[model samples]
Target: MAPISIRNNPDRLRYEVLDGDLAIGQAAYVDDGEGRRIFYHTVIDEDYGGQGLAGRLAAQALDETVAAGLMIVPVCPYIKNYLGKHTQYADNIQKPTPALLTVLNNALARRTRR
Candidate 1:
């Protein structure tokens, strides 16, 4: 397997992972001055799914956000659940509004059902 590489594609508004020559996963976000309010998605190629690549991608994205002095709005369910399990990241979390939480939940549900 090729080592995981996390890259920031400002034009795409997200961080992505390249596993060897393959694009294994991505964490999309939106940047507002207050912080990088992350949302929408993460998808690991089926071949890479069981290797914890998604978590690694999330960790890298979080690290980048912190390095940039930005907080996180984990509008993406993977991120919310990650923060839930990894309380250490709570410091960077920007509290979510109910509507936002609803949207995240819905996205998660949709993804899960697929």
Candidate 2:
């Protein structure tokens, strides 16, 4: 089995899951500059989808968010759902503002249409 490693790539607004030298998944986010991060997308390569990469990605990302003393605005459904199951990360979650909610909804809709 290939070993997977997780790393934050803030320059690209995402946390990546690396399988050796290959990137197999990512969870994308935007820093709101108000000490909060809005997670917007979580994706795994189709070939890598069933291997629990998304869970690993979510865990690392949320754990780092807490470590950074930042709150989470889970704009992405995958993240919202992940947090639901985990709950341990609940203390860091923040409700999004109306404007931010609109933006996130639009993003999700756009992806669904694609």
Candidate 3:
């Protein structure tokens, strides 16, 4: 098995989990550039599933976002469900507002077009 690690890839606007040099999972987000990062998607490769990589990814991503003084806006079902059980980040979580939803939708649309 390869060693696993996670890191923020700002250029791609996501937190990626790598097994050695191969990326196996990602928690994608969009920084609204106004104090919040909207996590819109998360996925772990099927081959890498059942290993808790998603939980680890979400934990580190949320940790870094809080450390950076940004609000957490979990729009992805996995992330949203994770947040419901993990209260450590409750203080940093911001309920999704209408405007924030729009921001996320627009960003996702651009990604689809590209």
Candidate 4:
């Protein structure tokens, strides 16, 4: 099996999951510019689904966000779900403000193509 790689794609506001040069999944987020990031989506191609990549994506996304000294506002069900099962990242989690919720929802709406 090829090793999986994940990294932030700032221009796209996503943490891209790569499998040996193949783009397999992504964890999407929006930065609030106030030292917090609102993560709203975690998706893997159906072909890649069921392989636990989504969990890896969530971990790496949260890990990178923490490394950047930012907090997390989980607006995505997938991410929220992931965090629920991983208490270690609880320190970085925060409740989203109404304004942040609006921004998160709109960013999610824009990703309909995904």
Q: What TM-score goes with each of the models? A: 0.76, 0.84, 0.94, 0.85
Whole-model lDDT, model 4: 0.87
Compared with the true structure, model 4 gives a TM-score of 0.85
Looking at model 3, which ten-residue stretch has the lowest summed lDDT? 19-28
Q: Give RMSD to native, each candidate.
A: 5.6, 4.0, 1.1, 2.8
* Candidate 4 per-residue C-alpha lDDT over 1-114 given as tens digits, one digit per residue, 9 for 90 to 100: 589888889988999999888878988889878899998878898987788889888988898899999999998899988899999989999988899898777776776757
In terms of TM-score, which candidate is stronger, 2 or 3?
Answer: 3
Q: Which stretches of candidate 4 lie over 4 Å from their true place?
A: 105-114
What Cα-based lDDT does every candidate model obtain? Answer: 0.75, 0.86, 0.94, 0.87
In the range 1-114, model 1's lDDT, one tens digit per residue, is 778888877766778889766667788876654454655677777876788878888888888888888878876788888878888877878877776666556655665697
The residue pairs found clashing in candidate 3 are none
Off by over 4 Å in 3: none
Query: Of the pair 1 and 2, which is ahead by lDDT?
Result: 2
Clash total of candidate 2:
0
Ranking by lDDT: 3, 4, 2, 1
Model 3 agreement with the true structure over 11-107: per-residue lDDT tens digits: 8998999998888899999999999999989999999999999999999999999999999998899999999999988899999999999999898
Q: lDDT by residue for model 2 over 12-109, one digit each (tens)?
A: 77999998978888999877667888898899999887878898899999999999999999878999999899888888999778977776666556
